[model samples]
Target: MILTAIVQTKAGTLVVDLPRDRIDLEMKIRSVGIERLSDQIHIIDDEEKSDISVKLFGESDIGRHLSLLFNENYTLFDVNKTMQFVANSVEDIRDDLEMNIIHDQYDTPAELVGDIERMTDEVGQYTETFYFPLVGNMEDDDDGEQYEVGNRYLRYYEYEIRELLQKEQDLDGTNMKDYFYDDDNAQKKMVSCQWDVVDRNNTLYGKVEFRLREPFTAEEKELVRSWCIGQAADGLGEGLEQRPIETEDGDLYVSMWNSGDDYFMYDEDEMNDYLAQQQGGVMTQ
Candidate 1:
């Protein structure tokens, strides 16, 4: 049940295949220094997608940080745990366990020395300062680290993201970016900043869709869009997809207080069926 893939090492000479089953979970946890057992845990899963991840919920006895991602959440655990609550007595299952454990360690000063390389663990920066232009990460900075800096509003991209944070407050892109980029507490009217807008997940592959209050040139429109999303994400702390979706009624707008999902869908048949159902529903109505 391991995620099948070839992983290249830091040295180009070494190419290692991912391990599905190497050791037992007990041994795995022990390897990561989970000795005292006061480790708090939180799990995020999408049952439909067969995805599950167990992460450190709070400070652990082992001062380090850890999280586990399984290819098939139920299958891996089911094979290992079988019917046990504790899952300590698992055998061949452990040797065949398919998952990845990311182990981050700290130095005497508590700054991360580095992530101890485990099976398929990706090396990471000790701390990351990310700007949320459209979505403020709701996930806790339980690593005792503030990886992402936020502003005020957050939405998945409801027009309200614009109406509420922009129209209501009169804050524009220049001000919004300045406010977010500044990690200081000072009396300030407006700060200057660059136009750095990222899609959800803080990546370049993000789509933002909307109409503006007054018409503007292309450059002006770009700044307005960035400000609109930045303001919404800084304020709301959460948001949905900002990509343009056209409907018979009009451009769909939502509130920051809601949630939705956008799959990287490749199921053409399924999508067609869904669209057909929606069309039927509309016609029926």
Candidate 2:
């Protein structure tokens, strides 16, 4: 017989796997204080925001009783207390009752929040560059283009999530402490912003960057570039950047302000050329 228990907290989730054979089931049941633990489960999550749940396997009678706690939430404090109860209950059950932790999901809020802050900082830097040239050229109206209230862009920020593994700890197999830890294996990145001119019907652009700790290979760089392009397309609901330059890896880095004037000028020239050809060398505004 096997029993599965899961405890979820604001920080993360923990899964414990318990396996016991039929021969020792009766003896283990009597030794392990399962009844005492079940009675105490109610005391957890008094605040009404419990984050824990459990599942029991084996005979129908025990499984039915355990099902009552399934999908229910419990406070972290109560969850910890329940785990201690289980640990102590199974201490004398012997090797016949095998319990192994199969899954653990943990998050480092401080590190994750820090990553967000850094991404925001990068966005700020980009915005500063965006307004710098426009501020300088505010008075210059040599081209037909003019900046109005609707020329600014909108910005969105969100976390890019992926499967994260927790770090290994120096604890025994039976200890639940190993199941909960402030560790992360995968890098956390974000698709920071999608830029579209407020009034113009231009292609939507997106920006994705990795604050990589290790240097990537040539192929890896290309992969990151492709990922950035795809993220932008998904966010914007349009295709890739209209005027992508030829580059070794890919022209993934986007300088919105630098290209703002150029795209407008290109559009104007294309329109002018089309009109000239249509009029047989005579152009009309």
Candidate 3:
């Protein structure tokens, strides 16, 4: 299984891929070495948060669970500094932890909270540019295989999707990662936004998709969708700070649905089909 570890530090946030057993996992993570190790492992499972980031410790996205080995607790923040990043106030967080533990919220207790500063040497939340990977059996396109996400996309817009992949060849890029960012942004604005070209009803459209990390509620999804639509066009997410987005951009409308989604399932074919049905005076199916 592919183990995705999202390591957040004082420098920058990183999304790493580590696939191995407990022993190997330990050696790989602690290759840099630390002063000491805790008596046990701990985890923060925040299924109730408004975002995809739950664990203050690294997020381990694997099919199953294993004992996590984290070290270097004595050097960093003391009780005061560490509690600053917890749920609410330090007092409230203590109560919350106690209640959550009694309610079976935390998967494992790990070492006691006396050991502050888990995982990496530095720790803090980066509100900007949150990184989370699309997990599960998503196969590479080269093998001509489609998993749950791709198969759903293929059901309706496979024809248009096939054409897009072919166009990707002449496009200059060493790999797919090149096209997965908004180049206009000075800093690397990736994972948050990505776009591609598609042919729909003979008109070229930008197939744009947005990501809403997790605890995906209806409001959060719409907020991200609207924001991406505003940016879908040529640097004008609102459609004209530099360019008009949505209708003006190749895409008719901006949209997003990840987290509890199969990547995204909408495509040009579905749009055309809806338009056709509307034109026929039949309600868009």
Best by lDDT: 3
CA RMSD per model (angstroms): 22.6, 20.8, 18.1
Q: Write the per-residue lDDT of candidate 1 for residues 1-285, one digit (tens) a residue.
A: 222212111222111112212234334434444341211211223334312233222133221122232223223222222112112212222332212122322321112111111211221111111222133333233442322213322224334344443332221112222344322221121112122233332232122222112234445434443554554443333323332223232343322221335322112234335445646633210
Arrange candidates, best lDDT first.
3, 2, 1
Better of 2 and 3 by lDDT: 3
Each model's lDDT: 0.27, 0.29, 0.31
Error of 2 at 154 (Å): 1.6
* Model 3 bad stretches (over 4 Å): 1-192, 211-215, 232-273, 278-285
Q: How do the residues 148-248 of candidate 2 rate in per-residue lDDT, one tens digit apiece? A: 21122221111110000010010111222122122222111211222222212221222222333343454544444444333333322232222222223
User: Whole-model lDDT for model 2 versus the true structure?
Assistant: 0.29
The TM-score values for the models, in the order shown, are 0.16, 0.22, 0.22
**Model 2 bad stretches (over 4 Å):** 1-44, 47-206, 236-285
TM-score of 1: 0.16
Candidate that would win on TM-score = 2
